[model samples]
Each structure stands twice: as structure tokens, then as C-alpha cells.
Target chain A: MDIFSFVNFFLLPGVVQGSIYALGAIGITLIYAIMRYGHFAHGDLATFGAFTALFVAGLLGLSPYAALPVAVVVAALLAIAIDWLFYAHLRRMPKIITTIASFGVALMLRSVVQIIWGVDTTSYTRGISRPENWFGIRVKPHELVTLLVVIGLVIALHLFLTRNKWGKAMRAMSDNPDLALLSGIDNNKVIAMTWVIAGGLCAASGFFLGLNTELRSLMGWNILLPTFAAAILGGVGRIEGAIVGGLVVGVTEELSVLVIPSEYKMLSSFAILLVVLLLRPTGLFRGKIL
Target chain B: MDWLSFTIYPVYLMIFMCIYGCLAIGLNIQWGYAGLFNAGLAGFFAVGAYTSAILTTSEAAGRLGGFDLPFPFGLAGAMIVSGLIAWPVGKICLRFRSDYLAIVTIGVAEAIRLVAKTEDWLTNSARGITGVPRPLGDLPYAQAQLAYLAIVGLILIVVYLLIERQAHAPWGRMMRAIRDNERAAVAMGKNVPVRRLEAFMLGSALMGLAGGLYVHLARTITPDAIDPMLVTFLVWIMVILGGSGNNRGVLLGAVIVWIIWSASEIVTDQLPAEFALKAKYGRMFLIGLLLQIVLRFRPEGLLPEKLRRAPLSEGALSPTGHGARIQAPHKEI
Candidate 1:
């Protein structure tokens, strides 16, 4: 097998997974900036979105694609609700305390999903179809869509963060909460907007993931660690960090199977996180300007 | 009394409450008092449990496996070995700030869990060593649990009291100083890193002791037996809810939270099969909701450690001092 061709088999899958990961990482990084702790629940939130999409698909009798937008909206609203009730109150607590609370929130949300959806894995009927040949390398429809979605979302998020006033306010709050408050930004509204945007994005990514692979309640728990690893690797509080870090993780993990057993793919991502932390805890690409 | 004869489970549950309670107190020392975040507590606890189970079980060591060391020695060995493993981790971990340490510690924990699942030579892999001869085989499983509970309970009480003493001592004061503001404490000539290491190591050692006891009581060890995030997060909830710097508060938080979290599981067991299974998760969601609410409402904890206001006499400032380091005026939740 050609090294590049063989690499494609793995690399193509990585991009799809990486895109899904990037979506989740963006939400995670956003949460870290606004909330100031790793949102352990992001994975579950993604799972929740996928589950919600599945629920909508079955209930409305819509195809997965048709129901996708609805699912995303519902999931985004649920994210808002969870934040409104749980996370919003934790702003004053110590960062670690809030983080621990967030873990509790994640656990609770996952448990709720387990209770509501049951543990059975569900997926779209059509799922991602066959791979299309691209330059002697084959990629699937969902994979292609995944790449497209990632690009679109990143561009969309970049526009939101840089161009939009709400995005600027969110960025300002993250940069200096006290200053933002003193400057007369409504912290609560900014916080809610942050939740709304992040939640919406999380839903979209989650739906894409469900499209790519099957959805299970444990899926959220499984990726929770990696989502965190990506966020940490990407400097925990930067969107660009999220994008770059996620791709690096995606490719590194895909490349890892060349040497290590595929069962340990996640370990590769974790290994990257450890090395990053030890060598440059601040992250590889560090600059104040996003 | 006759009508409530199934009261044994409550007793059993109470014992469980104690085991987790001990673990929570160990957490309190590290996270609450010292500001260390240990996400892999479940891993270390599992290590202790497997160590004790293997040392005592005939399946593990065979006839030669019978060091036949008394339970106390077995317990000591369990603690020693687990702490020995934790020592290097703590050393490496203590070199960093809280967040980085937390990320690495969680990874360490995840790695250990997988190792426990895959390490057939040590953990018997998934087949898990069965037929673990109970220390008191004559007693029924239920009765044995109570016995273990009593023993562990006494040990927990002792540990609590000891920590209580330490919390008031000058040494505890120094730890509090370090946790409240690391840079300030360092400016005062405290060895911040060393102080953090001591707290982290001591906490891990106690956690190991709890693990040894947990395995002995359960009489078996499995990879699934320990969930690292649950262990760490649950302890954090307990400590934070009880007031981070307060030993007494942790005890209360641990028992209350354990009972509440499990009560839902017990209730779920009675639920109409499908929904009941789901109820267990309901409890999890509620906990997350609760932690957020609890921290928001009472960041000081349900029974937060009171600010140390009692005067610290100069001569009384030793490790064995009566003041419990918490007596310093420094405030923390």
C-alpha cells in the first residue's frame, strides 16, 4: 500500500472525526473562556443533541437530514436551560469548585440521557454512505459533509467572534470579566448569548457526529476526555486554538494506528495533551489576539 | 424491628457510606485544604483494593501467596505499595499548577483503569480473581460487611480526629497559608512546592488505605470496580459542600451525599424496570444540578470549615499542636 494511500484510509476517517471533534472543542473552548473551567458536560451535550435529533427524526417521521435543524435547535435550547440552571450560578465560586460542579452537571445530564433514551445506541438510517474517490483517495459523503461543515462552522464562528457585537462583548467578558462588568456590559445577557451560540454550534457538530457514526449514551462520556484534551491542548480559551488543536489531535490519532493498536487511538490524543502540558502548558500557539 | 428486618441493607449502605466517607475525607485534605485536584482517585483506590485482595486471596498467590501476614500487615502493605506508586505521580504532579496537574492526573487515572482491565498478570484482567476467601468466612456476606464496617468506621473516626488535630496545628496553618494564596505564602518563605507535595502525598496515602479496606470488604476487584472521575468528583462535591477547609464538614458531606446518591439507585431498583434503570441516571443529573446549586448558594459549604480565629500560641505551633491549623483567620470555603 502506498504510504500516502494507506495514510488516507486512516487520515480520511480522522478528518471526519476531527471535524466533529473541532465542533465540540469550539464549544469547550468557549465554555472555558466564559465559564473558566473545562465543561465536562460538552460531550454529553453533544450526545444530547444527537439523541434529540434521533428523537425528532422518529417523532416527526422526518429523514435525519430534514430533522437535523430541529434537533440542533432543541439541543441548543437544552444547553441554555442547563446553563441557566446550573452553570450560571457558579460564576462566583472558585474555578475548581465550579469545575467540580460542572462535572456533577455532566454526570447528571448523562444520567438523565441514560434514563430518558436508555443505553441503546441509535443512528441515522442512511448514515454516511460510501466513500467518493478524491485524488485516488476515497472519502464518504458524511466525511465530505463533515469537512464542509467544519470549515463553514469555523468561518461562521470566526465571523461571529470578530464581527458581531455580541461576540465582541463575549470576548471582552472573557478577556476581563471585572473590566467588562465595569464597562457596563450586561454579564448575564452576554453569558446567555454565549450559551446560545455555543449550544447551537454544539448541536450542529453533534448531529454531524451522529451522522458519521452511531449514537449512544456512553458516546458523550467516551469523548468527554478527548474534548477536554483538545481544549487544553489548544490553550483552553481560544477558538483558533480549538481549531488547530482539534485537527492536530485528529491527524495525530489517525497517524498513531501506524504504530500502535487502533484500540488505543484515544491514548494518542491524551499523550499529545500530556506532552503539551509538560513542555508548554500555555499551548503551542500562544498569543493574546484571537 | 421484625417488620423492618431487611434493615441489613441500610446497615450495609451505612458501611458503604463510611468507606466513601473515608475516601471523601482523604479528598478533603487534598482538594479542600490543600487546593490539589485529584481526578484519578478511583484508580489509586482500585490499586489499593487489588493489592489487598491479591495479597490475601489464595487464587492470587497460592500457598506461597499466603504471606499469612495479619490483616493489619496486609493493610499496611497495601497502603505502602499504593502510596509508593502514588509517590512518583505526586512528585511529578506537584511540579505544576492546579489545572495542569488535574489534566495529567485524570490521564494517569484513565491509563490505570485500562491497565487494570488489561493487566491479567496483576488484576486477572476481566476474569477478576474470584473465590476470595473472606477474612471472616464464617460470617455471611452481610454480617461480614458489618464487621468490616465497624473496623473501617473506627479507623475512619481515628483518621478524622487525627486530621482534626492536624488541621488545628501550626503545620495545618502553614498548609492553609499556602492554599489561600500560593505566591504570598512563598513570599513568606514557605516551600510552596514541598508543601503541596506533602498534602498531595498524605492525601493519596490515606486514599490508598481506604482502597485496601474497600477491596477487603468487597472481597474482589474488577476494572469497573473503580471509576476515577466519580471518585474525584464525588469527593470534591463532598469537600466543597462540607466546606473545603473543614474536616468535620467533609465527614458530613460524604455520608449525606453518598446516601442520597445511592438512595436513588435503591429507589430505581424498585422502579418499573425500564424507567427504574433510568432513575439511577436521574440521580446523576440531580447531582450535577445540585453541585451547581450548592456551590452557588453555599460556596462556604453546608458546614464549611470555620475561619481559624483562635489564637495560635507560639510554643503550640508544632505538628502536634492543639490549634488545628484551621484556627488561623484566613478564610476559605
Candidate 2:
């Protein structure tokens, strides 16, 4: 493909989609690190967030981007409530039980979305968005917004993880919960904060995804494997690694159409995931596996 | 409901219960004995269904599978193909914790679904394969249903006996040992990975058989026939609730869960047109929530595994102590 066509068709769109995946991966990584189990409900939780945004946007007659904050709060609260109600009792149980419960939560969440919003695919805006020519590469307003929001969120998270006390405590917990507890960190607060951050990022991921394409009850469920792949590929616990992994997965998925049929793009992520697990389960950044 | 119709309803339901009973038993071998979580039961199920459908069905224009093979051959092909698919997935993930196995299985299931949807030449795309030959399909309606139920019941009995034998044998003991204490099993010179892989493959094969039976009964196969969460999670709940390690319990669980599931469908289907779709999802929400309640209140299930006395050794009881967690969290992914 020519440079302009490659950029327009693959690179640009890949990065935009990658940003959304990165946001979701960050949540997965956080949950994996702190909770010690995969949250199978995460994708549906994202669907919940996006549809929550859709609801707010419809009521207010505002752009979907304008409803991001309210949606994030709603999703965050829901995450916390889920953790408190369902997971807290199973803290002493086997990790697999919690994971299974998360699967249950996923189903519940998806059903809620389907019931509230119905199953039809809906978009933030009705009109077809015409991409603007920018140095021969096509760009859309929402794409630009997605990029800006991702960059902004990443920078803010970076600062929080480094400079904020709770963020540092979360890092400490991720490293070794027992040691962190011995060192006088409030494990409950750190757990709550982790959910907050993960939930917020999940909302952003779902919103940006809806902004880029369209929102369906299963939009998050479809991309879930890729998000998990990105998290695993980047190393399970590394923030920067998730972003890099997400972009690589995204770009490769888009670029794969050059050689293989476009329909098989989803298969590529699974291949990448298996290859990574075989070669380096620790991920590219040497993060913790669990 | 009339008494005769009600009697037939349960008979019809029994066929499904037997089919899903096979799936639950297969999972019991994997999770209950082996401690390997195979989350993509539906994927293996789909592989079996499609393979059997393609193998036994008469040919049509613009699609594959005109072999018109015998029913037994198609069923065996279903098992083999499903096991073949599980082999690679097991090889990759079995070396790790059950968590990785679970995630990879989900990935495999999703990829399989995508292929079933997009590969027109292979699966006939969304149209699906038709004319799958049933063993007693040529009979009158009630007779066919009764005959099919008999066939499925016989298969379930045979499978149950075979699996129950394995579960009580030295092999089953070794599997439980490996699951309870991997380190001890490894130190005892047990090939942990290989044994786990065998269980995984065996379970997948049974699931495939169930799928084959399902397709044959329906006389059709479609991408939409399988719902990953609905089938897989429901089976998981069945095994867990039925008593994971007990064959009889697994069968009982399958019957109970399937009844609740199908009966709920009947109820939801009766709702007004506008509320029908919402009620459908509402039922899903209830099933999902039911899993949580079961896990929380009754982790041992209705019929807990009958504990058997093991020949004691000092090596078996180590620092981990007795009653080791069912699935120890593996630090290394």
C-alpha cells in the first residue's frame, strides 16, 4: 500500500482503535494485578458504560463525548458495587470461583444493556462523518477527539501513579499485597481506588469505541479478546506496556488485511496471544504474569 | 398443561438433559478431577456439531459435505475433530495455570464462532448445514422423539459408565492427586502436563459427542445454534451444582438446570411482544445471578463428591497440609 493509503486505512485507524483497547487493557491489567483473577465481566461492563453514555446523551441531546464524565462515574460506581456485593464474600474462596462469578456478572451486565438499550446497533451521531484531508491522510473529528482524550488520560494516569499516594499504594499492592499490607497500606482503600481507575478507563474505552464506530450490546464483548491479548502481550501489570501492546495488536490487525482476508483479523490477536504465552508469558515489558 | 402433553414435555426435555449431561460429565473430568478449567465448552461443542453435520448430511449446491457417511462414523469424526482442536489449545495452556487455560479457551471459542460465521464454503456462512441424519428421524413424530430419547439415554449411560469407571480407577486418583497438589504429583514422577492434556482432550471429545447428538436431533446445524455463554456457562453451573466429581450428580444437575432454563424460556415466550425481548434478557440475567448464588451458598453442589480413602504417605501430606485449595493461584501466569 502507498504511504497515504497505509496511513489512512491502517495506521491512523489502528492507533485510534488501539487507544480504546489500551484503555480497556489497563482495566484488565489492574484487576488481574490486584484481584488475582480475570474479570470476565469486563467487556460487558464496558458495554454498560457505553450504553450509559448513550442514555445520558439522548436525554441531554449532547455529543457523546460530552457525556463521558457522567458515564464514567456511573460505571465506576457500578464496578465498586459489583466488587462489594459479589466478590467480597469470595475473597477467601478459590480464585477460580471469583473468576466464574465474574462471568456471571458479565452475563448480567450484558443482559441489562440489552434490556435497557435493546439489541440494535446505534451510533452517537446519525450522519456519516466525512474525514478531513490532513497532509493526504484522512482524519475525522471524533478520531481526533479519541486521540486527544487517550493521550490526556495516559499522561494523567502516569502522573497519578508516580506522584499520588494512593496510586503508589496501588503499585505497592500490585507488587506484593502481603508486603504492602505489612508496610501499613490500607488494602481496602487501595482496592477501591483500583476499581475506580479501572472503571473510569473502561468507560473511556467504551465511549471512544462508540464514538469511532457504533454502539451495540456486544461491541465490548467482541473486542474483549483483543483487549485481554494486549494486556497479556504487554505484560500483565505494566501501564506503559498495555498502551504499546494495544497499538501493536491494533496496527497488526489492521495491516493484516494486506495478506489475509479482513474477516480473520480477530484471529490474529488470538495467534499473537498464544505466541506470546508460549515464548514469553511475562510479556514484552517483563511484567508479572498473573 | 394436559397430562399426556406434560409427560411428553419431560420426555423431550430428557433428551436435552442427556445431551447436556454428557457435557457436564465431560467438564467434571476436566475441572473436578483434573482441575483444568476448559471455558470454551461451546467451541468444542460447535466443532462436534458442525463436523457431524457436515459428515452425515446429504450434499447441497454451493456448500461442502456430501459424504453421506454413516451416523457412527460422523459421531466418531465429531469426537476426533473436537479432540484435535483441543490438543493444540491444551498443549499451549496446560503448562500454565487453569486461568490461562480458561482465557485461551474463551479465545478459541470466539475464533471458532467467527470462522463459523464468515467461512461460507466451510459452514455455509449464516445459512448453516441442513439434513443431518438422525438415527430414528424416520419414525412418526412421537415415536421419533421417544426413540431419539432412548438413543440419547443409552449413549449417556454408556458414557457415564465409562467415565465413572475412570473416575474411580487409579487414573482418577492420580488426576485428583495432581489437581490437589501439583508439586507432590510432579515429585512423585507423574507427568502433570501430559495427564492434564489427556483429561482436557477426553473432556473435549465427550463434549463433541454431545454436540453431534444435538445436531442430529435438531436435523440442522447453524452458527447461531450455539451460544457460548448460554451453553458453556450453563454446563459449568450444572457440573458445579450437580456435584462436579459425581457422575450421577452431574446428570441430575443437567436435568434440573435445563428444566429451569427451558421452562423459563417458555414463560418468557408468553410475554407481550414488546416485553418479550426484554424478558428474554431478563431470564439470562437470572441464570447468571443463579450461578453467583450457587457458588456462594452451595459450592459443594447438591451432591458433593463422595470422598474416598487414599493410601496415606508422608510425601502426600506436606507443608500445604490437608484440604489444599481446589485451584491454587499460580503466581506465574
Candidate 3:
């Protein structure tokens, strides 16, 4: 294949896919850092958010992008409600219990989605758009939008974490929960805030994924391993690391077709996860071991 | 339904209950005794199911088979292969926190599913392997089922007795010590990693045996049979609800959960066609909700682990130390 075709088929799609994985990984890493438990329901929550946006777009007769913020807000609220309903009581128990509980929540969320949406693959728009050629490179409009949105969200998150007081409190809590509480950080509030950010980002990721590819109930679940792979690869808890990890995993998955069967693309991420967990559980950015 | 047919339904249910009993007991060994979270029960179950299917099947053109082995050999092959796979997986993942093990096992299960789906030469791809022989399978339908049930029941009883023996043995006590307090276990000169691996492999072997029993009963195996929801999570709820750390409790749990699960399917099938599909998902939602309720209200389960001695007041049944936080030096962003 020519370089242009390779870039079009492999590099461009990889970057767009990476952006989506990055968005989801950020949510996972944040929740891992703050809650100290892997949220198994995260992928399903993203599915819920994506479907919620689809619902809002259809209801309001607006473009999918116009309905994105509504989905984000709704998902954030749902995240908080779920924590209160299913996870809050388990906080005093082992974190593993909370993790198991999250798996239950995952099943519930997926079933809810299946019940509402009827388990059909769907897209935001009816017709596909052709990629515009720019200096020997081809880029689709939605793909460009996805990258822009991811960049904007990351920049906004970076500013918020570095400048905002609540953000600092979240960092403190993640760094040392007991010390953060000793320093008068309201633990519950910080946790709630963490959910808001994670949930919103999760929605954005799901929305973009739906926009780019068709949405199915299993879409979120299928991508879950790769997203987790990205989180751990970036060294769990490091925002920049998650982004880089997401890009690496995405690109690797896209490029793997050249060497292995396309049916086995998902294996690349699983392999990365195993290798990373075995060699450097601290991740690329030297995140917490847990 | 006719009286004989009706009687067969309960027998069929009992047979499945025995299969799940094996699965639940296996999980109890890992999660209850060793505190090793293996979320990939379906993978091991699949490994066993396919191995037995291939072993006992008369012949096949595309896939690996034609061993035409007996039922006993198939079951044994299943256990041996499943245990071999678990050895490497346990060696690598047992060092991490239970949650990481959960995710990794989930990955392993998915990977296994992928392999089963795509590897046509090995698993016959999506069409799946068929026509595996069953022991005493040539008898009349009712007689065949009864004989199979007897065989499975005997196996379950034997497994229960053996595991119960192990649970009371010194090996079991060492496992509990490691689970309840890893540091203390290590300080006491126990080989924590090796012991954990032992429990993991043993439990996996049991799951494989259950898979073998299931494949023989069905006379066929399919990639779709290895559902994470049905095979993995259901067994988890069974073990948790029955009471981890107690073999008899998990067996009770298996029976109760399997009855509820199968009975709920029957009830949902009675709904109008339009609602029946939705009710299936709704039932899953309820099962998921049931887990939350159990975890919230009765973490110790229906029959709490009966202590031979006074239990540790703090971190009772907790897998890891409550206050043992790993200190990672903070670096400037």
C-alpha cells in the first residue's frame, strides 16, 4: 500500500480511535486514583451516556454534537447516584468488594441499555461522509471534530486540575486520602467531584465513538479492555500518561492488522496489559502500584 | 406436561445444579479460602468443555479430534488442560491486588472467547464442535439422563468430600492465614505466592471438570456456551451468596441460585412475545440488583463462615489489610 493509503487506513483511524480511548481511560484512571477501585461499570456507563445523547438528539431534533452536553450532565448525575446507591455503603469494606459490586452495576447498566434501545447497532447520522484530502492526507469531518474535542477537554481538565481549589483537593485525596481528610478536605465532596469529571469525560468518549462508528450495546464492553490497557499503560492516575497510552494502544491495534489477523486486533491490547502488569504495574508515568 | 416428562425436568435441573455446584465450590476455593479473585471462570470452563468435546468426539474433518476417548478420559483431559493454563496465569497475576486480578482474568476470558470464535481448526470456529459421546448415553432418554445425573452427582459428592477434607487440613488453614493477613502469613515463613498458585490451579481444575460434565450431558459444545454472564458471574453470586470459605455453603448457594435463575427463565418465557424479550433483560437487571442487595446487607452471606475459634475482630473476611497502604513517593507534575 502507498504511504497515503497507509496513513488513511491506519494512522488517521488510529489517532481518532486513540482519542476516544484516551477520553475513556482518563475517566478510568481518575476513578482508580480517587476511589482506589477499578470501576468495571465504566464501559457500560459510557454506553449509557452515548445512548442518552442519542435519545436527547432524537428528542430535541438537534445534531448529536448539540446533545453532547446534556448527555455529559446526565451521565455525571447518574454516576453520583450509582455511587450512593450501590457503592457508598461498601466504602468501609475491602475495595475489592466495591469492584465486584461494580461488575453487578455493569450488568445492570447493559441490561438497561438493551431494554431501552433493543440491542440494535445504530449511528448518529444516516449516511457516511467522505474524508477530505489535505496535502496527501485524508481526514473525515467527524474524526477532526473528535480530535479537537479531545484536545479541548484535556486542556480544560489540565487547567482545572492545576488552578482550581476543588481540583487540588481531588489531587490531595488521590495522593493520600487520610492526609487529605486530615487537612480538612471533605472526602465526600472530592469523591463526588471526581465522579462528575470522570462521568462527563466518559460521555464525551462514548459520544465520539458512536459518532465515528456505529453504536451497539456491546461496543462499550468490547472496548473496555483496550481502555483499561491505556489507563495502566499510561501508569494509572497520570492524565498525560493515559493520553499517550491511549494513543499507543489505539495505533498499535490499528497497525496490528498488518502482522496478525484483523479478527485478533483486540489481542494486542490484552498483550500490552499483561506485559505492563507483569513488568511495570506502576505504569509508564510511575503511578501508584494499586 | 406428562408425568414422566415433568419428572425429567426436575432431574435435568438437578443435573445442572450439580454442575454449578462444582463451579461454586471451585470459586469458593479461590475467593473464599485463598482470596484470589479469578473473574475468568468462563475461560477455564470453556477450556475444559472444548477439550472434552474434542477428546471424546468420534472424528472431525476440520478441527482437532477423533481421539474417540471415553467419558472419564475427556473429563480428566479437561481438568489437566485447565490446570495447566491456570499455572502460568496464576504465576503472573497472583502478585497483584485482587482487583487487578479481576480485570486481568476478565481479559483472559475475553481472549479465550475470541480464540474460540475465530480458530476454526481448533474449535471449529463459530459452528462449534458437536456429537461428543456421553457415558451410558445409549440408554433410553429418561434412563440416560438418570444415569448421567447419577454420574455427575457421584462426582459432585466426591469433589465435595475431597475439598472439605482439604479445607480442614493444614493447607486450608495456611490459605486462610494468607488471605486474612498476607504479611503475617509471609512472616510465618509460608510461601504465599506458591500457595496462592496451588489454590488457583486446583479451583480451575474443578471448573474444568464441571465443563466436562456439562459437555457430556449436552452432547455438543459451542463457542456461545462460554458466556461470561452465565458461567462466570452466576457462579460468583452462588459462591458469595452460599458463603465463601465454606464448601457446603457454596453448594447450597449453587442450588438456590440455579433454581432461581432457571425458574425465572420459565416465568419470563410465559410473558407475551413482545414483553418476553424485554423481560429477559429485566431478569438480568434483577439478578444484578440482587447482588447489590446481598453485598450491602449480608456481606457474610446466608450461612456465615463458622469459625472454629474466635475470629479476628477487625478485617474479618477482608482480603487485604485495611490500613496497609502502599506509599509511593509523590513526584512533581
In order of listing, the candidates' clash counts read: 14, 0, 1
User: Which digits, one per residue and each the tens of the lDDT, describe model 1 over residues B124-193?
Assistant: 7777766545556468656666677778889889888998899889878888878766668889899977
- DockQ of predicted model 3: 0.55
Instruction: Give the poorly placed runs of model 2, Cα more than 4 Å off.
Output: B1-7, B309-333
A4 Cα displacement, candidate 3 (Å): 2.0
Clashing pairs in 2: none
| TM per candidate, chain B | 0.86, 0.92, 0.92
lDDT of 2 by residue, B1-333 (tens): 444454677788888999999999989989888878888999999999999999998888888879999998899999999999999999999887677888899999988898999998899989999878899788767778888899899988999999989988889889888877688889999999899999999999999999999999989888988888889989988987887778888888998999999999898888899998799899889988888888778777888777644458664565444344333323332
* Clash pairs for candidate 3: A235-A283
Alpha-carbon local distance difference test for all models? 0.73, 0.87, 0.88
Which lDDT value does model 1 have at A34?
76
Model 3 ranges with Cα > 4 A deviation: B1-3, B310-333
| Ranking of all candidate structures by their lDDT, best first | 3, 2, 1
- The RMSD of every model to the true structure, in order and in angstroms, is 4.9, 2.3, 3.6
Q: Report iRMS values in order.
A: 5.7, 2.6, 6.4
